[model samples]
Target: MFAIVFILLLFSTGDSILIGKIQNSTIIDVTHISLFNITLNQCICKLITVSGIIPAANYFPGNQSCQLFNFNNNSSLISSNFNTYWIFTNQSSAFITNTSITSTSSPTTSISSSSTTTSTTTSSTTSLSTTSTSTTTSSSTTTTTGCTNLGMFPYQSTYSVGVSPQSVAVVDVNSDNKPDIIVANFGSNTVGVLLNVGNGTFLSQTNYSVGSAPESVAVVDVNSDNKPDIIVANTLSTNVGVLLNTGNGIFRNQTTYAVGTQPWSVTVSDVNNDNKPDIIVANFGSNTVSVLLNAGNGTFLTQTTYTVGTSPMSVAVVDVNSDNKPDIIVANSLSNNVGVLLNTGSGTFLGQVTYITGTNPKSVGIVDVNNDTKPDIIVANYANTISVLLNRGNGTFLNATTYLIGLSPLSVAVVDVNSDNYPDITVANSLSNAVGVLLNT
Candidate 1:
């Protein structure tokens, strides 16, 4: 019953779908996810679908242990070490004997419904080739949320994207609650949209042509529609392009707004409190930042430019001074520092003040580090370090406390990794080719 065995591995919720469960093994909690339950599929499905996380749920029928695993990117599935082998027991009998095997969903999906003995004579094994499964359907479906955890693990998969993909933003494009990916494909001169199809896989990437060499992408409802739209900083085109989400995952053609030279990054915020989203872009070549106030109906006035440090490559919006209004933060790469431009009333900003970072800062993020209501700054420096600059009450910041993390800290984000309520720092190390997570104490 390879056909029947394959149908029981799928896990699905409202819109959140697990990639697939690891074969027919009971979940061994190797990831130390202290989920105590006598029922098998209910606990794993609830843990995966309701948890908003895609942690690897490995199945080990023996002892009913659930496992969590980590795999590197661009690798194949390794089973003997990782324990993801499959087994298709003869299901003609009502009960399984000798071995430990568990399942999350009902197995009636692929079984014969005509007669009681009809499935009893079915062949139970198929050619699942090299991997350790006795006989399994390779591409079949079942109600499963278990992710593959071998090389990059099979579940944390990679989509063949356009060449030289740059900045990426995640949002639910379709009405489904599943998150989708929007990436700026710089080398291919387009934007790639990969939508989740509730199976472990995604629909083929839908690529939309935009301005030349799009470097960064952001999502916002620019036209006041609830549907989110795509915006990209076209570096070579020296402009910003907007792709309105017509409905579903579809988008209209590129509508261009000229900006400074080489707009490397872009972000959106309501700068004037007009309830409409505005665009902020970092012009790398021009050494300035442009604020495009959303005029009406997805259009912007001539950009209002503000001077910043040399080669401002990244832009972010945060209330850095506790002023309730959104302020701007830019990483001036050539200047090796970050510039903070405080917001004045009515879409205007004062002069930018400089704070030193490591050599060549590339990205910046805002988070409340010490539970101090005031937002602090976390910067990713290209020189193999992360700089944490704490806020000092008013609109200023203290000298940064730096940490050596990896080869090249290219990107940074803040999240509470261990559910400890304290924020943690994660970095994408470009040179070392790793992701480092520093937990908060």
Candidate 2:
């Protein structure tokens, strides 16, 4: 005589793949008893239950009241009031009991003609089971197809800069959605601009003359105009060069402004929150950061110098303290540390605080590397290493984690090259005569 028993098993969705379910069976002794409760409000809850049971056998669903067997026939069958579902994989086929028979029987399982169904049966009996029959649907897995291996920083292609490319900036020129590149050619006394071709490649580079020995470049919209302007630090000329954008990837001739001696890096931001952008240049020769207040017509007033550590080679602007005011961070190469200048909201800076770093820190970039919402600092040390300083959300940083890179890395830029939602590091290796990319893992 055939006996009918009802059992309910909870299956959650996780990393486990659903195989097939068994129905209308008398459950045997459930030795490894565990309880899991789930509300049937949605299909996601059921998927979660199945996910928890993967790589393991047997799961109890519905309050601690339901008992689920491991599909073994060694124990006696019992009657249950709860509804039960059996999920199995090809490896667990040997343990599955016949669906209609209370006794032990070898059953054969096969993939059904329908893509989503699986069939199982014994020589003398046939039983059908369906795994997912709920009205709620779940999204399929999304994969970034055609992506290169996560850790492989394959060399894409490189364009030749003028003589010595000291620093680089990434921005969209010509209103293109892709990021173009600007390189400060120190030996050529000019800056090179490469328009991105929408793919990973760039168009032929166009060179724009600046003052003597341009060492750094920053792109911004300085004149309340939508077009991005270029700012260059002319190291030997001891001044800052501003090239107003005339639209469509074209820039007017350099408009020079006097600052402290030997300005090695340039960055632009609304320093006083006046809605008009201001310029900040790291003056290496004078050991100061020159703040040039913008006049809103692509011109700036005379610079006000703020003393910083020795030989500051790079400067980055960010609201490090979450104070809504833009602050400054400088990489002091000779001092072997980074200096933080807090914005006092009046276009003036408070006394600087120094954070120790590796030898000859050349460049600094801000990015949220850990997805923590706080901006962290990435520094290129001339001593053959790159350092990552995690932000503490209070304008301070935790200890740095350093990674070895090519020899004499002079500059760094962060970009998401693989569309992987993680920022990768690109370094200009001065002595190596090559650009090194560190793929984010």
- Indicate which candidate wins on lDDT: 1
186: Cα error in model 1, Å: 0.5
Report the poorest 10 consecutive residues by lDDT, candidate 2. 129-138
- Candidate 2 at residue 252, lDDT? 86
Against the hidden true structure, what lDDT does model 2 obtain?
Answer: 0.72
User: For model 1, what is the C-alpha lDDT against the true structure?
Assistant: 0.73
By TM-score, the best candidate is 1
TM-scores, all candidates, are: 0.71, 0.58
lDDT of 1 by residue, 1-441 (tens): 122222233333343433334544322222333232113554345445444444345543432333433322221222222235432121122232233122222222232333221110111222221222221122222233453222223345779889899888888887688778899999999999999887757777899999899999998889987888999999999999999998798999989999999999999999888989999999999999999999979999889999999999888998888767899999999998999999996899999999999988988989988888888899999999999999997979999999998997888999887778889999999999899998888
Candidate 1 lands at a TM-score of 0.71
RMSD of each: 11.2, 15.5
Badly placed stretches (over 4 Å) of model 1 are 1-22, 25-154
- Single out the weakest 10-residue window by summed lDDT for candidate 1: 116-125
